[model samples]
Target: MAEVKLFGAWGSPYCCRIEVALKLKGVEYEFIDEDVHNKKSPSLLKYNPVHKKVPVLVHNGKPICESLVILEYIDETWEEGPSLLPKDPYERAMVRFWTKFLDEKCMPAMRKACLSRGEEQERAKEESTELLKFLEGTVSGKKFFGGDNIGMVDIVANFISYWFIIGQELVGLQVLTKEKFPKLGEWMDEYLNTIIIKENLPPKDKLTAMFQARFEAAATATATAAAAGGGGGGGGAPK
Candidate 1:
């Protein structure tokens, strides 16, 4: 068997995507935890010089970075698991389209809401819900965006299943609810409750605390920057 090792962070949804892929494939891998806050590992830099981020998969001494790219790689290399992408080329393209939308639109908006305040948070929440609504329309009847079973779309949107909800709670907003967005709300519930997904999620309480800390840190950094700006000579010279 080719040696497989994963470089990941505890709270990273990106890392979880790779982990879920490996688990579903029944492939055993050594996990390396990256401390992204204080100091990133040299190997992470060496492996993924562009991003220098977590969820870098080193397989048989070669490194693969980017969660979505890593997922494609895993599916292609290991034939044991269910296919991540759909069979029909058009369906595969659609899956890729939705996956890209999640990464580019919905996820980033939710993230902004989680880490911002007041008007900015409201704007982010609004933007997030709007994109989510678009997604709901796109994958309306599908149990998972990838279909009846979990697939690439499901894996990429996994953040919506747990972290997005947790982030909403931590930030005190409710953009994704059953009443307003029935399809997305139901999909989140079903996607999350699936056996492999449920077992592999970051604990809710722990994720809450992590986001709480991040929110505070962002607040502090913003406040400090504001204070420095106010005190600096950028304004007209004081009398």
Candidate 2:
């Protein structure tokens, strides 16, 4: 049996993070696709009892949950190749800080945009725009988040490369357009063009279609709730 195994879903950007890290580290692992939305496998539950989430990396029967944590574990375990964290303590701290920012602030905004409509959608768009602007400013003259080479923070923040673009298409928003956020847009191109990142990303049209279906399903659920008179006690119809 393979010493390392990864439980993941195809459409999950979280899963993609671990995949990229493992590939970058040149670790050979078994890939298990878990149906995150529907039913999870027994192994997934056994591995990650707390979150029961995908992207669980099981090494020698011990499981590591959370994509970021798994990346750190991989980095520490496999000391070969380019380092994910910076050598300097301050630079490493900055990387962690930005990665946390992307996870907490940027991801939430993007999720909101995915599941929202009307005023709520507008608010999400605004928030996403602000987050993108902040990221753009941070990258002002830097080649990558880790300065010269890609690091853990860059790998973690890479969801903005393909997933965010898919989110824009699915949610029918243009928050990260070239005109609105040119620097960020350029940065996205640069990131995606990188050898490791480019090779690991999912197919564009396929991801777009998957997200579109999810968006429509969420909208349908909202409409169904409104029809059943169980929607947040609103006077007007769903936008």
How many pairs of residues in model 2 come into backbone collision? 0
Residues 1-239, model 2: lDDT tens digits: 44999999876788888888888888888899998777989999998899888889999989999887888888889887778887788987887788889998998887777677778778888889888888888877877766767788778877787787777766577877878767667677777898888877878877877776777777877778879996721122111
Consecutive 10-residue window with the lowest summed lDDT within model 1: 230-239
Tens-place lDDT digits, model 1, residues 113-222: 77776677788878987888887886698887877888898899888878887777766788887788888888888888788988888887887877777777777766
Q: Mind sharing the TM-score for model 2?
A: 0.91
Error of 2 at 21 (Å): 1.0
- How many clashing residue pairs, candidate 1? 0
Clashing pairs in 1: none
Candidate 2, residue 5: the lDDT equals 91
* True-structure RMSD for candidate 1: 5.8
